[model samples]
Target: MSLKSFGAKIFASYIRKKIDKWASQPEATQQKVFRELIEKGKNTKFGQDHDFKNIKTYKDFTQKVPIRDYEELRFYVDKMVAGEVDVLWPGKPLYYAKTSGTTSGAKYIPLTKDSMPAHINAARNAILCYIDETGNAKFVDGKMIFLQGSPEMDEKNGVKLGRLSGIVAHYVPAYLQKNRMPSWKTNCIEDWETKVDAIVEETIHEDMSVISGIPSWVQMYFERLQQKTGKKVGELFPNFNLFIYGGVHYEPYRAKFENLIGRRVASIELYPASEGFFAFQDKQNEKGMLLQLDSGMFYEFIRSDEFFEENPKRLTIGDVEKGVNYVIIVSTNAGLWGYNMGDTIQFTSLKPYRVIVSGRIKHYISAFGEHVIGKEVEEAMQEAMRSTKARISEFTVAPQITPENDELPYHEWFIEFEEEPENMDEFHRILEKTLQEQNSYYFDLIEGKILQPLKITTIPRGGFNHYMKSIGKLGGQFKLARLSNDRKIAEVLEENLRKYNK
Candidate 1:
């Protein structure tokens, strides 16, 4: 190897060693490490400027700071845009991660040096743990394809850093960096057509071991790959061993992926946001383990049941228990203190911190003007899937209000099935029964006949593609939204209803 490549190999080796050491630590030791980072953050310039200097412990830290969302961070971002040296973090942010601010409009989130490590380490651990679980470290011998957003640097900010994908590409050791598909310089998230073409062209002759990115985008790529190769993805990329996915739930898209790929691809669920990488799938059979970045942030959890209670209970990482749903809060080195990310999680176990993403706290659907949370929808869907004995490929639920019928509201489903059900009406009844039983409001409405019969729209193959195209969103990162159980569902459902009405 050349001298530069040799140096990169050494650096990559060092990173691997550090990651293994961190992952092998006992839960208690890991917590201590986290506490130390939180303490150090309290002393840093960011802490003082953000009112964290006086906070000595996690309790004091969370109490003094109020929970903040992306909108509040936008205030800090505006200052950064004006060239403020320090606002949220100690130094000027290297660049911002542009995220779809679904509810709050567009948001440019600060990505600082201290914060970058957390994101990188979380992602690295996800990969390492996947290898450990599958006993497939040798799969790394082949090239990995990360179907990600373009790396074009934001010219307006006078920042050289590309989006998160680009920024991560730059930080990876040079040797492995060269192995990246569609070289960073050429990939642009906005230029989807060209980027996708480039990715397909570049990987045509390469041996692929792992593929990672948003499931929607990866699915799109595989569809294109099928057309181009005239062969399924399995035939074209037989060596691919793992599928690392995040950004959205995989349940809806799982079977489709398995069908296209022709083998069971090991999956790793990653929790990444523009702000930082928070958790990842740590074991093979178990759900994702919340690997606390004890060195990056102090963690807190607000019990899901108590989230709206008169005096809701908030628990530290130390206080979390098995099987309870919680909203994750964090105080990170990058200057975010007591920030609530709005994602809901349920602990599978307490000993090792295993948790499954329940849903977004803010994202839910209830059409009868009753609150229907993500957990409710998940349970109802699970029951529906079981009752019908039908494998759901993808689905989204919304409330429909019939015109001229003021008192009647109905639930509408846009469903993609693995195989056509023998009796469509029976399938709908099973789903309706499941929903009514799972959600009390639906049950009451159905009994009173105040609610219209549930409507079902069976989508044609590639229906998600049409949906993604309609929104001008690339399939890779977008998710099917279960809009509020009220009028919001009507707006979201309208588009899908129009597309899949047949």
Candidate 2:
């Protein structure tokens, strides 16, 4: 490794030490540290000079800044796109991270130098915590493969700015960065075929230790690797130790991945978006421990019960009670004072502030008033897949309401299997039993015969391809909407269900 790269690794090591020290502190001390950061943020030029002067205290901050959705940020993004000054972040945003939302169309989130550090630090700390937990620093010594988005930098006017992943790649230790798939110079946004092909070619012969990316993309990449090498991932990349996945839940894909890799890969979950890296799974063996960037943002949680009530109350992060589901709201360094991420999460423990991501606030199917969230659905699906010994590539649930009949709405499942089951009826029976066992609401509804029987529709090998093609998004970035608990997602699934099932 070059001297510069060596220096970067040393610097990263220093950051890791600081994080470890911070993690070892008492919960009260951590809260103090967070408060200090918020105070510092309030004093920033952009903070005081902007609308943050009114947000002196946590309560004031939450009250004054109403919760904003992505639609509210669209105008600001348009201004940024048009080269307007002082809009989203403090400085001119380097590049916009293009992502889609449940309700909205394509969203362009601004990524600035100030905000980028949070994402980089969160990701780095996640890795460090993993190493500390697993005692696997030797693994870090090997080449790390990041299955990331297109590496191309966007150019506006004369200034060239890299994508969020590209900017993040800049912060990675230079020594390890050299071994990245697609090399930083490749045009990631050119086309899906070109990008996937490049990734396949570059990763075929590398000694990869840590492999990281979204589960969907990584699954596809692993399949391609198998095809190229004429061997499964375990035979091809025998040295891989850690499998870091984010952008979606890992449980559904866990068994299949383990079967292909021939070993139990250490998995880490990251809750990140174009806006920021909100939380990460601290412990590799346990569920996610959400170390809130208290310094970066003030948080609020709307109680699930209250949300369904006529008049809802918003609970501050301090007021959150353990074991109840709540929607998250944030007041961040970015111009977004209070933004609702539209995600529902429950605090598993309050002392260390660990949380279980329940589902999207909007991603639930309540046709029969059962109030089932994504978490319940996911758990059900996973249990079903396990029991039936069926490998699912992708799946979605849609509520079926019959106008002519008074029977409660039923759930229709569109499953894309890795291999067809010989006994399809047995598969369906196992799935229904799993769902009934996993969710009390589903169980009660099914036992009462309020809902119709669970309908299973198995698709051809390229079912997802047809769905993606119909939506004009057939590529690495496209992912199946896991939780269709809302109307918009239901509508999309309805259209696709008609196309595939009919």
Candidate 3:
């Protein structure tokens, strides 16, 4: 082995020890993390504004700082954007990670000096931990290609704004950048289609070992690669073994990905957003990610079901129970305090604090008393696909609660298919059966005749993509919400279908 590769392995060993050490004392590490954040930022403007110095305990801290959403926190973030020092954090943030709003306006979340390493190191350790657990590190010697966002960042009052992945790209280790696929220029292309073309041209024959991205965008890249190479991805890059994914659930796209690659590759799931790198898969046999307890972020959980309660119970690490859905609230080094990041998670295990991404707090269908989460919908799609052997390109579900005239209220699905099943009725039957089995409320509604069966509409080719482009949310960091208890997204899908039919 080369000296450089040997050096990489040695450094990875050090990070693995750090991960394992924290795993042994999950709660203690979490407490230390919380205390450290308070200690470090207690003198900052936000800290002083919230009386952080007087806050002696978690209970005291929560009592002092109320939970806030992005809009509520915007005043402080805007001041930071306007070159105000010590407004949120102690100083100006290094960059603002802009989120691609699905149906709403964009948000600029901050990335600070202290917060940057928490994000980068967590990702680095995720891979190192995977290698430690599985004894699979061949990928480390080859390319680690991540389908990242544009490197082009817009500056507002001396603050840089770009997608979190693009911001992350700037922090790629010096060793990996030598083998990271596609030039910075190609990744900076704003057009998704154009970018895919350039990426295909750039990395068609490079020695790729690992690939990472949101499933939809990466699928586009894989499809383009197949068309160009006239071979399965596995055939083109035999060493390709690891896939690290976040942003959306991978179950619905599982079969399609497997088919494209010609085989199943080992995978890891991550729970990262513009807020911070919250968690990543740490165990090969485990279902959930080991939460990052020492990542300079303090996590609080509010029962997901009771998120809108007049004064919802805020639970810390010690109070969180397993198997319950909770909306994640974060206090970060980037100056966010008791902020609701909007993502909902459920603890699959408590001893080591492993969690699964249940759904977005905003993305669920419960209009007819059927509280179907993103995970459930993804599972139903996966089950139906498995049973009927159909594959979908992309899909979204919405509650059609206020039906016009004689139509009964029901859930509606707008789907784009790579290959449609020959028997659509069978596909629906299997999907509906799985959903009913998964969600008791929906089953009860159907049995009581209070709601009709679910509705499925086949979107025309490129219809969803057309809608995305029309709304200026065409690619990178844009994840079409999988479920909503509203008709806004469903209506747009219907409109796109109509336009395509014409």
Candidate 4:
């Protein structure tokens, strides 16, 4: 047996064993987890403020700690950055995950020595679970090329700061590091164009077996590799059998991704964010990821329909029902109290509990009360793309409610396409019809003439790239908001589209 292949088998076996233990647990395990996190932080200021000492059950915890977004959480984070120990998490945060903010300019989410493993372990288990399912241990023996941002970190107050991907890069096991391509020096290059080129140059001929990154950047890397090698991805990296992706939904890009690879590869979907690594795709046949119940975070759910109500009902793990969209509220070991992750999810299964991200609370368009979301638009667009034989590179959507010069209100789509459909009118018709089918409210608006037919404006090839770079958010976990209630992003892309015209 080859030495590296032997090692792959051993590692894969270990991961599968761990996952077996995690999956075999009872639903009551979630309650035990909630108690554990509360006890872990009971001495911290946040814990005390929330009356964690006396909080014994889900109802008590909910009544004590309220749902909060970044704006409310920033004060404690600033205290952490200014050398406060046990402000949020006990002691200082191990790292601060810095992400771009539209209004606040920057957001710093905490990670602790204890809670950091939740992020790392969920990622490792996902690949391991894939190996278990397919018996593909040889992937472990070959190199992996992760298209991540610069690992270089800055300091805030006293805490180290970088993108979550960048921060996590520092902790990749030494054994894996040897087989990972793109030297840290190359990965540290701040400009994405320069970094991707170096990555292509570094790994084009290696024994690459696994690839991981967001879909957009992965597309860029694949394009660059094809340009350099003049061959399909499968031809370039014959050992490649696995693709790990997160940060955004993959269904919209699935067709394009498959075409780029030139062959089918196993795909694992993960639900990871700056706040925590919440879930992982345990089985390919499953519609949603299995929530990581033991991962140092207690989960709570509030029905999205009632989230805007004066008082929303908080549902515990046992109380949640399948097919209802819920805004996730979490209390984590890192000491975030009743933190609203801002991501919306819906359970596809409740026996062991699995969820798919439905949308973002802030990332929606309901300007005319149509109340549309990311998952709805993405699915509609994918269906339209398929029916029309079109391929979009990137896109964003917003409601055009306020008529300018007495124009009709509509939903505007700013899209960049790798292959524009021959029938633009039919392509648009499908988009409008699919959306009407996805959201009844949207359909009613169209039926009532409250909304004009949706409009599409073609963005020049590099319009999204220009916008991301313009905002200093070109890489890592940053992605263009797919839908918004406002037209700010549409305006930027419209101006970029003008450049092509000129």
Candidate 5:
């Protein structure tokens, strides 16, 4: 191993020990984090407004501070944006992770000096954990490509603001600088397609060992490389061995990615968001990511089924049960308190507190009261792919509540296939059967004749990309929802399909 690799291995060993120490005592570590957050929060403007002075316990906190989404918290955030000091956190945020909002047009999540290390360290430790487990640190010596947003930023009130991925680009550690690909100038290009084309040219001939990005964006880069060289990714970059990704589940894209790379690679799954760096895959063979209890963020959970109730019971880490879907809430050192992250996760291992993201709170198909979530759809798709040997590029689901011929309404699945299945009817049957097995409400709806069997609408090649492009959300942390209650995305797909087929 090179000296850098040797040093990395030693450092990884050290971090593993530290992580193990805390993971073994998850609840106590969390209580310490909670106490620190509360102590630090006592002096902020928000704390005074919310009666944080009298809050002495978790129950007091619950009573003093109600859960708030971005919109609800905007009153404080707006002051921070306008250069107010100590409105949310002490002084101004070090940076603002600007992201598209749900009800509001845009959101600026604070990243303070204290909270920034959690994001950086969690990402770094994920790779270190991989090196430690696999005993392969040579990849650290090779070229590493991170397909991400432009690092360019705009300034407001002395705070740098940009996409979360873009903001993170400015903080790539010194040791990895020489090994990183797609030069700074190339990353700053505002247009994604042009930027990706430039990246293809820059890294096509490099000895790339680690390539990290969301799967959809990385697939685009891979396809461009193949088109240029007419070779599988594995052949072009023989040293490439690790694929790290976050945002969406990897199972649905596994077949297509394997076909593109021409081989399977060791992969790591990360649970990161603009709100916080939540979890990272710690073991090579583990089923779920090890939760970051010592990351300066205290976690709370509300059962997914009862999340809509007026007074849903919010449980702490010690009270949570394995396998139950819960909406993850967080109070972070970044000064976000009682923040609902809008993501649902299920604990897979309570002994070490590992979790897998199950779905989004708002992304589901429940037109007929089925309440099918992203995890179920992705699971059903995985089963169908396995049974039929089909390869899918991308897909989304929307409820078709009105049929022209007086037939019962059904869910419309818009799929873009990498390789079409030979037995279309069988593929459909597998998807339907697997979904029925996963969701009882959907099965009851079909059995009661309230809804018909789901239908598939094949999107032409590049159609989903075109749809995303048409809406100006083509790349860079943008991912299509697995399912929607309404037909907004479905109609766009239909429109793009017509344009593509012509």
Candidate 6:
């Protein structure tokens, strides 16, 4: 092994010891984080307004600080954007991670000097954990690429503003700078398509070992690589063995990715957002990402079913149960207090406190009261593909409450196929059956004739990309929602289908 790989192994071992120390005592670590956040936050404007002085317990904290989403918390964020200091955190944030918002246009989440290390360290620890688990640090010597947004940041009131990935681009560590790919110039390209083409040209001949990005965008990069080299990604980059990804689950895209690479490579799933770096996969054989109990953030959960109810109960780590879906809330050093992250997660292991992101709280289909979530649909797709040997590139589900010919309403699945199934009917059947088995409300609706079985709409190859590009969200942290309550995305995809067929 090279000196770099040898050094990486030693570092990985050191990191693992620290991780194990906290992981083994999840509750105690969390209590420390909770106390630290409260102690520091009490002097801030938000803490003062919320009466943080007398907040002595988790119960007191929850009662005093109601759960608020970005919209509710924006009053203080707007103050920070206007050059206010000590508005949320102890002082002004170092940067603002600009993310696309649904109702609020654009959201600028704070990244404080104290909070930035969590983001950087969590990303680094993800890789080190992988190395420590598998003893595969040789990849450290090869080129690495992370397909992301432009690293060129804009400024708002002297605060740097950019996509979270772009912000992370600035912190790629001194050791990995020599190994990082595409150069800063290529990464600064504004257009994703142009940037990807530039990336393919730059890295085609390099010894790439690790590639990181969202699965969909990275899929585009892989397709471009194949077009240029006429070889599988694994063959083109023989050393490429680790794919680090976040933002979306990888299971649905796994078959298509393995086909493109012509082999399977290990992957690390990360649960990160603009708000904070939350969790990362620590074990290759584990089912979920290990929750970051010691990451300078205090976590709370409300059962997703009761999330909208009046005064829902807030549960901390000790109160959580395995397999039950709960909306994740956090109060962080970044000064988000009792913040509703809007994403739902389910614990897989309570001992070390690991979780799988179930779905977004708002991104579910309950049009017919079935209340189907992203996890259910993703699992069903996995089962259908496994049973039928089909390969799907991408897909989305939306409630079609009305159909032509005055037929009963049903769910519509828009899919782009990598390899069309030999038996489309069988594939559809399996998908519907699996969904029915998992979701009782959906099963009841189908059986009771309130809704028809789900139908599949085949989208042309690259149709999803076309739809995304049409809306100016083709790349860089923009992901297609797996489930929508309305027909907004479905309508555009339907239009794309027509345009493609014509």
Location of the lowest summed lDDT over 10 successive residues in candidate 4: 19-28
Q: Which scores higher on TM-score, 2 or 4? A: 4
Clashing pairs in 4: none
What is the C-alpha local distance difference test score of each model? 0.67, 0.68, 0.86, 0.85, 0.93, 0.93
Show where candidate 5 strays beyond 4 Å. Answer: none
lDDT per residue as tens, model 5, 61-148: 9999999888989999999999999988888899999998878888999999999988999999999999888889999999999988
Cα RMSD, each candidate: 4.3, 4.0, 1.8, 1.8, 0.9, 0.9
Better of 4 and 6 by lDDT: 6
> Which lDDT tens digits does candidate 1 get at residues 1-502?
3454344345455655665565555355546755665555554444565566565665675566667777765565677667766566665776777667766766676677777887777777667655544545655566877777666666435644445766676566454665556566556546565667778888877888788888767876776787788887878888887888887777656666777787677788887876667778777777666655454766778986577676576677667777766888776666665677788888886656667777777766544545556666656666666555566556667667664647466766777676666777787777677767766776777788877767876766666555656666653445666545555534544566675675
Off by over 4 Å in 2: 1-17, 20-51, 73-82, 88-91, 101-105, 155-163, 185-189, 308-311, 403-408, 420-426, 485-502
What is the clash count for each candidate, in the order shown?
A: 13, 3, 0, 0, 0, 0
Q: Write the per-residue lDDT of candidate 2 for residues 1-502, one digit (tens) a residue.
A: 5554455456556755675564455344435644643554564444554456565556565455556688875666666667766655555766667666445765666666556678877887777666666556666656777766556666664334544565566577555566555566453545555666777787778887788887877887787787777887867777787888776788888877877777787788887766678778887656655655443655667987567565468776567788788988775655455577777888876655777788877777777776777777778778767777767777778777673457666887877788655777887887777677766788888878888778876666666666676676766556676656544554655577677667
lDDT of 3 by residue, 1-502 (tens): 6565566567777888877788788778878988888888888778888898998888899789999988888888778877888887887888999885434477889899999998998888888878777766667788878888888898988889888988898988888888887788898898998998999988888888999999998998999999998899999999999999998888888989999999999999888877889999988788899898888888899998799889999988888988888999999988888999888999998878899998989889888667889888888899889888898889999888678997888888899988898889999998899999988999999999988998899987667778788877788678788888778888788877777778
TM-score of each: 0.84, 0.85, 0.96, 0.96, 0.99, 0.99
Pairs of colliding residues, candidate 6: none
When summed lDDT is taken over every stretch of 10 residues in candidate 2, the lowest stretch is 25-34
| Clash number for candidate 4 | 0
Local lDDT at 440 for model 3: 90
Residue 174 in model 1: lDDT: 54
TM-score quality measure for candidate 5: 0.99
